[model samples]
Target: MRTALTIAGSDSGGGAGIQADLKSFASVGVHGTSAITCVTAQNTRSVDSIFPIPVAEIRKQLRAVLGDFDVRAAKTGMLFSAEIVRTVAKELRGTSFPLVVDPVMVATVGARLEQDDFADALGDHLLGLAALATPNRFEAERLSGIRIDDVESMEAAARAILRLGPKAVLVKGGHTKGVLVDVLYDGRRMRRLRGRRYPKTLHGAGCTLAASTAAYLALGRPLLAAVESARRKVAAGFRQSYRAGHGVEIIDSHAVPD
Candidate 1:
């Protein structure tokens, strides 16, 4: 079976982070491997605390997986610090497989996930190595310094982010008011992917999208097709989402039909 890896934190709630990534990978029929960067005490409602795994031990996990498995593609989620971000970047440098970078900044419950200086490290070391970078509206605004009020500004932000060296950028418009639209740009052209706005706020939607894309890439699909497939998968997952806790609904990507 083809394999994919997720370099991310472990969410005890099983709603997001490594748990979500692995579930998304399995849904797409890809073997999921992971190198946990941190462990978080979080649930649907809040993130109480986070403990970063030692950089040396994190490297060992990466080496073990990379050395033993034919990892066809990979995605990164919550790297809690600048050092961990740089470490992951260094490990993935020059790798042949596609990488989907989910620039995770804040949790679904409005808690900050990354360190204050993490953004600089991510932009400098990691974004350049991505095959695709998936950032939501707020993250796009932070990364591109452009406020995305409409499709035009979304495209502008994608363009600005593309200049940071990712092969493609998907500026997710999930935070917008009406019907959802995600602007995808691959430098040559821009495509607007539209999806319905579900009533419930689902946790881990972004992680699922990026992870599914990585799994599809591991399955040898092209970048555009993989992204489209991933989006559809997440949409379906949201439809079937259930409350795993008293707070937000968990996006059950595994509940979707393969």
Candidate 2:
């Protein structure tokens, strides 16, 4: 079976981060491995606190996994500090693995997940190594310094981010006003993926999307095909979402069809 790795934080709520990534990987027929970068005291409602793991420990975990497992692809979520980002980049260097970076800067409930300095490290070291980078509206604004108000601006932001060296960029439009439209730019072609705006917000949708994409890549699917499949999986999970807390629903990764 194919194997994929998630280098991310742990969500106590089991709705995002490593928990969601593992579930998404399993849903897509990939064996999941993980290197927890931090632990968040959070639920569907809010992130109360986050405790970042030491760089040494994070390095050890990455080394252990990359050394043993035949990891075909990997994804990064919440690297909480510049130190962690640099450490992860160092460890991942020289490997030919396809990386899916979900620039997880903030929680769904508006909690900050990383230090401001980490942004620079992410752009400088991590993004250049990524095969694909998935950033939401807010994250794209932060990463590209482009305020996205419409599809045109979103396209500009995707182009700006693509310049940072990621082979492809998916500017997620979930936070947009009306119909959701995710823009994908691979420096050559651009595609817009539109979906109905669900009445209820769902937690872990981004995590599930990125992880499922990594799983597909691990199975040897091409970039665009993997992203398309992952988007469908996320939509299915959204349809199967349930109210796990008082704030928002939680996507059910297990509900994604085979």
Candidate 2: clashing pairs of residues: none
| lDDT agreement of model 1 with the native | 0.93
* Candidate 2 lDDT tens digits, 1-258: 989999999999999999999999997789999999999999989999999999999999999999999999999999989899999999999999899999999898888998979888899999999999999999999999999999999999999999998999999998888778999999999999888677777889889999999999999999999998888888888888998778888999876655
Where is the poorest 10-residue window by lDDT in model 1?
A: 249-258
Candidate 1 regions with alpha-carbon error over 4 angstroms:
none
Give the Å shift of residue 44 in candidate 1: 0.9
lDDT of each: 0.93, 0.93
Give the number of colliding residue pairs in candidate 1: 0
lDDT of 1 by residue, 188-236 (tens): 9999999888887789999999999999999999999999889889988
